[model samples]
Target: MLLCPYNILHKAERRKLLHAIGRCLFSSWDSPVYFSDVVLADIFTSFAQVVGDVWLSLCMLLPGHSILKPHTGVGSRWILPTVMSLPYLIRLRQCVIEYNHQGNTHRRPLYNALKYASAFPAIYLSAAQGMVVGEGGAAATWFGGSHIFRLWLLAGMVNSLYSFWWDVTNDWGLDLLRPRSEAKKSESLRSPPRRLVLPGLHSATPHILQGSSSIDVHDPEGISRSVVELSVRKRCHALGLRHSLHFPLLVYPFVIFLNLVLRLTWSMKLFSVVNVNSHAGIANFCLKMAELFRRWMWVFIRVEWEMIKKSRESHTKHRADDGIDEYELIPSATIERTPN
Candidate 1:
């Protein structure tokens, strides 16, 4: 068992070396071993589906753009897309099942299955041209009675997208989107920090590492932390026991999600957005501005919280002259005075 761990550490070290070489060659060295296969599969599955949907949506726009009248016997026009969506949906089901089978604690099986189920209708709508308003459009067949039903259908699609995003990101672990090597490369590119030793008499010296941001100093062994850390880390690195995870591209998806939510919220206002001719650009802009204002408020609150934390820590951590902690001091019932 010990040898097994030792061997695993060796492999991790090899990955580290490969990561360094990849940086020199400017390639994705830190990508998961199966990353290329995953990328290709996603291209076929996700990218192809997106391309097909955009094609159909654009085809509908042909009437508005005056390109040509859309095809009669719409069934023939949509047959391929509808057929294609079956495999996409099947793949999604299989993926969720397989993920559950893997015994992933971080991802819930039933929740993922439900999310996938939720996404199916939206996928079907996009693929089958269900949103088009005329001549057996999905909206007409399902909710032609009133505009309220139509808005409800649109809300369902939005909810599907929202649920789908949450499932995908959380299930797959956003770190899988980018290679660990890339994250390390960015980490390595930062300037070396300068340590400032603050004057203090204690078990550990209170100091700061001078850099772009102030960092807490936890070591006081009178040795370079990096060297000691590397040695200990090398010994502790167990290949199969410890897995590496990193995702630098998560921010992009979050930004996209924020915009999507903003757009959806904009659509919800005044029910005017659901009308055929009305536009929601003004609402979208206003919501985006409101989101920015909220973010600014959050930043201010965080800064104040940091200040409060520091004040508390400073007053709480002192050691008494009697080698007792400041908190250990108790109220004495009687007082004694020294006479000179």
Candidate 2:
């Protein structure tokens, strides 16, 4: 809701900026169906499953070799696929929850069955990919400076878990996914639920004996509909806050630091040169998985950001309407008139 200062820009340019930024900031807030919320559910989740399976296929090319490849048996062969399929598994669960409940009863079984079509492929492929990629030896064995290999591995694990939680909550509702203690701890941070009151409509017939407090009215249809919609909206607000992604207060920053430091220090050396050539297939599949996750995240983050913008805008508008001129709700494009 921060207004862009357009004093330097021409009127037309300012108008264009306002429109683009307004959209960038906020989209669907009151509506249950966010435009991009289901984008991953309908398409990308299944796509990732396919990519994972390809990796599995590549792993099959070299049988019985550990993820620690050149090292042979240091790490479990299944580690890579298990880590890789975390996102796919999370999405599959979300798909079941979101799509399975929609549409007619007869097609529900068909819809659920299709989730497996993607899920199984991704799981198998990831397992294969994990098994084939041999390790580059001990982190200290190769790079020697601080054993950064473990850092990258941990980062990957944490990021996947974080993303899984984000998808789960957004598809369902936040309150449904939140642990009870976490919910209680964060209770003071959320905005309070709005109260719904249709003022004069609720009590039209005053009871004189009850000091005009008790009353009844049953004549108007228009007022009744307003009451119903308002009730539903209020109930929604009370039910829960909107769900979206967030980094853990403490862990996210450290994860960022670790990624920057390790990637800078180890770079391509983290993966063995021989495996890079031998496991080109698995590498390609990993890229596909990364691409899939990046796209899914972009959708979730962008749309959720839009909602945040909208919510802020609504708040600012409310304040402005209440005569708080300190924060103007006026668009930047509106031209001010100067009398001659």
Report the Cα RMSD per candidate.
17.6, 20.3
Give lDDT per model, in order.
0.39, 0.41
| Per-residue lDDT over 162-240 for candidate 1, one digit per residue giving the tens place of the 0 to 100 score | 5435432342222223355643343233212213323133325443332223224445454355445445433322211
TM-score of candidate 1 to 2 decimals: 0.35
Best TM-score among the predictions, by candidate number: 1
Worst 10 residues of 2 by lDDT: 206-215
Output the number of the lDDT-best candidate: 2
lDDT of 2 at 95: 44
Candidate 2 TM-score, C-alpha based: 0.32
lDDT of 2 at 266: 26
User: In candidate 2, what are the lDDT values of residues 1-340, reduced to their tens digit?
Assistant: 2355656547666665555434323433332333343453444443543543455456655666444332324354444445445545544444444444544355432444353333343343333333333343334243432334354344444444444444334332344356766664444244322222232432342221111132233335645654665466444434443323243323323433333343322212222222323445666556545544545444554465557656656764564465312222332113244334
**Model 1's lDDT to the true fold?**
0.39
